[model samples]
Target: MIDLHVHTAISDSSLSISEVVRLAKDKGISHLAITDHDTTKGLQEAIKVGYEIGINIVPGIEISAYDYQRDKRAHILGLYIEPGHPSLNMLCAPLVQRRKQASYEMFRKIKAAGYDISWVDVQKYEGGTGVYKQHIMHALLDKGYCGSIYDDLYKRLFQRGNTPKTQGIAYIQLEYIDARAAILAVREAGGIAILAHPGQLNNYDAIDEWVELGLGGIEVFHPSHQEDDRQKSMLYAQKHKLVITGGSDFHGFYGDKPIELGCHELGEECIDELLQRIKR
Candidate 1:
């Protein structure tokens, strides 16, 4: 099976790249993409490990972008990308720094709220590029504030609201790269740019606009996508001649919910379409 979407500890995933790759190999996944969020810090190591273990590792990334006009999140996934390409680093490096800053601010709020968490506590759990909200939650979970990462407490503390006072106390708005720039950067980095999980973020309305910006594919299968969503994405792909792909979006224990590796299948035809477009 091929899992076109995945994350490792290089981002928010709880498992390291080697562990993720080994697990996928055990589950019979032949092709696995390490599309960690905004960073390609360990793709070369993962590629090396996957090569030795007989799994094809696709160097990829998921950019946290936004549709400014529609005012919604529109993440872009670059498949078969050249890890550390200048375009990607230029577009995403600031995003990583911004997120790290926001997370520290959130940590401050959480600590002020009487949570017994500390920076060292959070850092020890963080396996890669900067501190994620999940890292903070890991600390809180240990302090008995929450049972799981995405539980009610997580929503109450982190979910976005209309205004500052109304928003989650720990929530801070992040500056995301424009969706157009995200697609263009991915293309400049020599990969096919795919609109990721449009259903989850209601980004359907922006697909036509993004396709014009060189959005080359759509994620028809994702943990967040329902049957109707799958059909809609497939229809969109047909209408636009976009490559169709899917994956587990696995983040190990840091996932929003439980899911398995290689649970979603991307047929060879669809996989071949992406492979043919890959310039890296």
Candidate 2:
């Protein structure tokens, strides 16, 4: 089985590249993609580890993008990316800075809220690619400021809506490139751009628009997707003659539930089709 979406410590995940490879091997995942958010920095290390561990590691990335026409944000997954693609690097450069700036602001807000935390505390969890909200939350949890990662404490502080006590501590939103640009960057990098987890986006209405913008496929199966969502995505893919892919979206110990490396996966047939698309 193949999982096309995954994140490592280079992004918001708790697991390192080597650790993720080991867990994927243990879970019997034959093929995997280290689709870290906004960066491909981990792919080289993951590819090296996968070679030693007998698993196929596909270089990939997940770009956070916005659709200005629809006023919505979505994640675009680039599978089988060229690690040193100039276009990918160009697109990610600004994002890296943007993420760091946002993280700095978030840390300041949290510190001002009287939490015994600092930017240095949050930076300790980052793997040098960028700082994520998860890293900040993890730091807060580690310092006993929050009981659970996704509990009320998290919502109160980071989520948009909160009680008066936590209202001023809300998360700062980061700027993102348009989804069209993300899809184009993937194409420029010689990778297939797949819409990631439409169910989570709740933006199926914009699928046709995305296709027009050069989206090559859809994430038909995901940890966050239900059976009905998978069926809907399958039908959509069939209708559009698009490749279908799935993955665990693994981010060890970072999510609400226990997300195993290969808990969700693409069958051999789906993998074959996706591979064919990449080869084309």
- Against the hidden reference, what TM-scores do the models get? 0.97, 0.94
Tens digits of per-residue lDDT, candidate 2, 173-202, equal 678878888999998888899999999887
Model number with the top lDDT: 1
1-280: candidate 1 lDDT, tens digit per residue: 8898999998999999999999999999888989999987899999999999999898999999998998888889999889999999999999999999999999999899888888999999877789999999999999899999999889878988888767777999999999899999999988999999989998988889889989999999999999999999999999999999898999999998889998445756666788877732
The Cα error of candidate 2 at residue 214, in Å, is 2.2
Off by over 4 Å in 2: 161-168, 263-265
RMSD of each: 1.3, 2.0
**Residue 20's lDDT in candidate 1:** 99
